[model samples]
Target: MIKVGIVGGTGYTGVELLRLLARHSGVKLQAVTSRKEAGMKVAEMYPSLRGWVDLAFSTPEDARLTECDVVFFATPNGIAMQQTGELLDAGVKVIDLAADYRIKDLSEWSKWYGMQHASPDLVEEAVYGLPEINRAAIRDARLIANPGCYPTAVQLGFLPLIEAGVIDAGSLIADCKSGVSGAGRKAEVGALFAEAGDNFKAYGVAGHRHLPEIRQGLTRIAGVDVGLTFVPHLTPLIRGIHATLYAKITQDVDLQALFEQRYLGEQFVDVLPAGSHPETRSVRGANVCRIAVHRPQGGDTVVILSVIDNLVKGAAGQAVQNMNILFDLPEGTGLDIVPLLP
Candidate 1:
């Protein structure tokens, strides 16, 4: 069994990782660290894992993460870079579910995240952990930088169009709406239920941190700097992201066929029927990105609707998917979970 340790096991993504890893047939739960919650029983904090996850929270220094086969950092943005190098040196594969190593430009990362990268040299070596796009690199990588929630949905939505060169890359737009959980399991005035309950508002319109990461991925695919107007909104829900993408069509081609063929064998990306509209709830609690391509009135623009559970496919679930790839297991081995419905 693959021994696994998790850093920062108190957040939503952290517990979600514990839930999934506890049931993985090929894994053995090793240690989970949470400085503030050290010595607390995992199941006591998250009753959802009562019967399965029997480990307790250990402080980072006491977790001995280097002894595990793999360690997942579900901590805040700056925490992973501080410890990933040591773990890598000890032969433990590292997957950081944060922005620590996603962007290659050290200066750009510092400017956006507001901190000096603790390990900039490892940035170039860390593979972007998007299975659909970076599967081969992930297989051989010792450090994996998991893509952010917004970037995952947006990139997957725009990938086929950019790759086929059927859309004007310079005018790409991603208007995304995410549930409050996307804010993380934290206490903030913005995330309070009474504040976000019935409200619908957009934040980060001028700029969002995910912008550079998304642009980096798209530019690599298009072989040029892609122009993207990314605007993110907060919806009055708890756990999903719906990305409505737009691009002016540059050529006439069967978009449905293109998307279908592009993701033909992809296990987690679902291409809905031609005129179907995918709902965020359809992918809730599952590591699947359901997409529908549309050309209203056969106009000059194409609209792609994509949805995923922000905490699942967008975070914890995708991290597990990356771990599966790093170990050469079936991509969906522990991620074949069905989406939760109302």
Candidate 2:
């Protein structure tokens, strides 16, 4: 069995990882670290895992965390970079759910995250863990950097067009809306229900951190530097992301044929019928990305709509999928399940 350890085990992503990994056939829960919740029963903190995970939150230390074969860092940015090398040195593979290793350039990483990257040398070896695009790289990588929720939905929505050279990369604009949980489980006044509910307004329009990461992903697939105007907002609900992307098609492009042909054999990505719109609830709790295409009259712009559960496809579930690839296991071994809807 694959013994697994999780750092920063008290957050939303951390608990979601425990929820999936607890029932995972090939994994064994070994250690979970939390600085403040040390010596506390993990199940007590999140009663949802009372019977499944039988462990306590421990302090973050090299010796305690290095025991597992694979470790997941669900902490904030900069925390993973500090100990990634040490864990890798001790023969433990790592997958960071934070933004630590997402951006390639160290200067850019510093500029956006507002901290110096602790391990720039290992940046070359760290693979960006989006299973659909970088599966092979993730298989051989000892350290994987998972993408942000907004970036995941946005990138997957535009990848095919960009890859086929049908759209002009400079004119891409992403307008995304995410559920409240995407903000994490921190105690902040702005994230409270009163502030977020019955409210739909944009934040981080001036400059969001995910902007560079989105550009980096597009640049890799398009083989050119792509420009983006990304604006994200908070929805009242608790768990999903809906991304609407608009781009100018430079060439003669058959929208339906392009999407259908591109995702022919893709298991998790569902390209809906010609005019069908997919709702966020349709893909909740599933590792699925539902996409639709539209072309309005009198314009060369092609609009793409993509939806995914922010916590599942966007975070924990995708992390587990990356682990499956890194261990040479079936990509859908532990994630081939249906979405949970009300």
- Tell me, by TM-score, which candidate is best: 1
lDDT of 2 at 329: 81
Worst 10 residues of 1 by lDDT: 333-342
What is the per-residue lDDT of model 1 for residues 166-213, given as tens digits with 9 covering 90 to 100?
999999999999999999899999999999999999999989999999
Q: TM-score per candidate, in order? A: 0.99, 0.97
- C-alpha lDDT score of every prediction, in listed order: 0.95, 0.91
Residue 189 of model 2 has an lDDT of 79
lDDT tens readout by residue for model 2, 259-337: 9888888778899999888899999888889999998783899999999988888999899999999898877777877
- Model 2 ranges off by over 4 Å: none
lDDT of 1: 0.95
Clashing pairs in 2: none
- How high a TM-score does candidate 2 get? 0.97
